[model samples]
Target: MMRRHPSHLRLKPLAKQVIVITGATSGIGLSTARAAAARGAALVLAARNEDALKAVAEDLSSKGAEVAFVAADVGREADVRAIAAVAVSRFGGFDTWVNNAGVTIVGPAEQTSLDDQRRLFDTNYWGVVYGSLAAIDQFQNQAGGGALINVGAGDVALPLQAAFFASKHAVKGFTDALRTELMAAHAPVSVTLIKPSGADTPGKDNARNLTGAPIAHPAGIYATPLVAQAILYAAEHRTRELTVGSGGRLLALASQVAPALTDPLLAIGARLNARIAKAPDPARIDNLHHAGRDLRERSFQPGVRETSLYATAQMKPKTTLGLMAAAALAAGFAFKLGARKAAPIDE
Candidate 1:
């Protein structure tokens, strides 16, 4: 039902407008890439995974989407610069660049490693910094207006994942200031910030770099298709700021209404999660593909099919009531299943 937006949307004037995506090897990056590709955008995928990048490119190419990729780690300035270069070389220049490369660090602050803290800044925060600078310079060079979108998480904050939260918070602040600076100077290129909840991503397993805390909540059988869709829509519309997930919106609300109350509560959650939450240890986690224990085991509905990220965004006045009813039934059914599983073990 989502018709193509017209050639103007696709071409965006001049030659094919390139789309640059960091952390394009997996998770929301990969999914978002697919969405953009479907919309007829040429892609310049950036990631540390050369083989994976090739595979994605080939797969998408087979489907008739023009794609190219670079093996660059956004954590490093040089690597990020190279990534931008690849995009310019391959497609001339990008119309949109997505800063999505990031890592998660979970656990208590006391136990978190300095190495992880550094990496968190490197990938989660500095990655955005490096990517932004790279994109801005390219936009300036091309003398063309483009966009920079930084993929974010949760709300403005989350106590348990202090390091992770800090990284995102840093991004949010940096982006807000950058947005204002650009506007003040009247730069044609735009900046956007995408705040999504813990999505259904392989990043959950790879993010186990922290032995102390967790980087994110595990994804279950049901994924946040709507959130993913929101990112794509935001990209199309060139929206400045976006928040995904009901929980994410609620967290924003909580932060505003009662910071004092939320702060202590978050601190308590952080403390408890440090000892509990028995997720993967830093050593056990890998950046490569690894799906952790199924979050769906607790809440999966047998007959319900997953809603695609694209579908998730389509639920408006037209689709809201149906979604809510289905969600309510799903919650109750999931509880019933959980109780049944627990009762036998208790016996």
Candidate 2:
């Protein structure tokens, strides 16, 4: 079980919240469903896999969770809309909508075909777009305000998965813009972007593999439950953004502070990490063309990180910011000292 932050205890009970989760058949989405179910929240699960969806829904329902399943592809706007319809028709209007359905491709940018790139965006980018719109419309029409949570990446770029990273960047930008609009209108809607780093999930295995070499999740990966914690947190409390994993936070920070240096480092790290974490080929049955292959709640690998720094950061933002500021200052001082020592002596 993942550790819950102090703030998590402060949020109102989720017993009455009608929560809608896309891609709920596996990974973080399925984990979030389990978390929310434990909290007594009514749920509507959406995914392309009918059998997997039914199995999850039944399992949750048997466990006393008010859960229902909708077999729909998030890539299609109509399917996304249908998901919302199911949420309302079954559990009443959903109080939170999680746009977590996404897919990625593994390969160099140039090597990835335009068709594959476009298809990736269709699920990763367009899926969030459609789900967000539907949730926004529902929230605007309803009496009570609602939360719209979209899962993005901590680092805007990930080596070897250029198209996937680009789509995540798009999601971040789109969500930021939508939040601005909501604030400007004084809308009672909370738009949150959850940025999780690599987690032990079947996502890596399910991604379309264009790379001839085997790929795997890097070391220091976090468990999927940590992300589920963030998702459930967002479902209750309003947050602008929450980034999961310390490694992810560090990479995001480095990218922001020193992009030129960080890019090359990330490229090298990504390549080396993949090579080190190579896994046996599961027949390379990628989910680019469709879904339903590796239906799993967690990946085969056990994530190293036990607790989430993201959760702690979310609860104590000011303290975390102060610590980050101190670290930055210390690093700056060290760099200055190094430069001064390297300078030629006047004598």
Candidate 3:
């Protein structure tokens, strides 16, 4: 029972418009699926897990959602084509497509294998590429413009997640190019890039299944319900870029105005993270998804503080800073407690 305020409900995009959502088995995609169903939109859910997809479709159907689902590894072209086929066969045709299925392997580039990194790109980056092509085809045939919503992240240059960040950076550049081309030629397809911060969802738990480990960062920062509400609003508004998390949007803004300063700031973060990092065995696949879940810790939003330029001088006093640092050490130890049990997945 996810209860939303009246304002949170999206307008039913007319029965003429069908929508397809990838990564719909969980997380942001799952939340969006539920929201879209609530709005009376015909739906198509895509994910690699067949059982999970079926379950989601059934749940939505019980709620009177005109939903169908397909299980496919988005990394493959034929599979993605089949996903679009499922949408067409079940719902007639699609008016919107969301590229939301993704994966992340977080660690130093040196320790992460090129093979594994490429696999991540195959899904995170290429998966979206395939979706856009399909959507463009449908929109071109349908007359007016339809939307393609892409899932992105705030940390385009974060050090710890080379593959993940690289895929997102590629999405940023790809969307830019796609939007430009559409505008230049007057193509009837619209693109929206969604950059959201840590969404509290099934992403980390699912990633653990792939890498057989846990993430090196806390997952609760996402405020999933809030982000989900934002996505629906973005769709109705046809927003070009939507940064949901307040802190995350600020970080993105700072990165733009002062690249030189932000570079060093991240460099400092990387160094601190590395120095404090307890390296997992590079060879351990059975326990190698996201760093054993010991990365859990809460980060305050710090409120609407002064600009980043003024942030350094305004930091907490040295005595308090030292005490906070000591607490971080203790919190880091408490992180180990979160690894108490493995996440259960039907797959």
Q: Which candidate is the best by TM-score?
A: 2
lDDT score at residue 298, model 1, on the 0-100 scale: 18
Q: Report how far residue 200 has shifted in candidate 2, in Å.
A: 1.5
TM-score of each: 0.73, 0.86, 0.71
| lDDT by residue (tens digit), candidate 1, 86-122 | 8888778788788988777555577777776887788
Candidate 1 lDDT score relative to the true structure = 0.68
Estimate every model's Cα lDDT from 0 to 1: 0.68, 0.83, 0.66
Candidate 3 — what's its lDDT?
Answer: 0.66
Could you give candidate 3's per-residue lDDT for residues 104-136 as a string of tens digits? 665677778888888888888899999888877
How far out, in Å, is residue 251 in model 3? Answer: 1.4
Off by over 4 Å in 1: 1-16, 209-225, 259-284, 288-347
Tell me the deviation in Å of residue 103 in model 2.
0.6
- Score residue 314 of candidate 1 by CA lDDT: 43
Model 2 TM-score, all chains together: 0.86
| lDDT (Cα, 0-100) at 338 in candidate 2 | 100
Quick one: ranking by lDDT, best first? 2, 1, 3
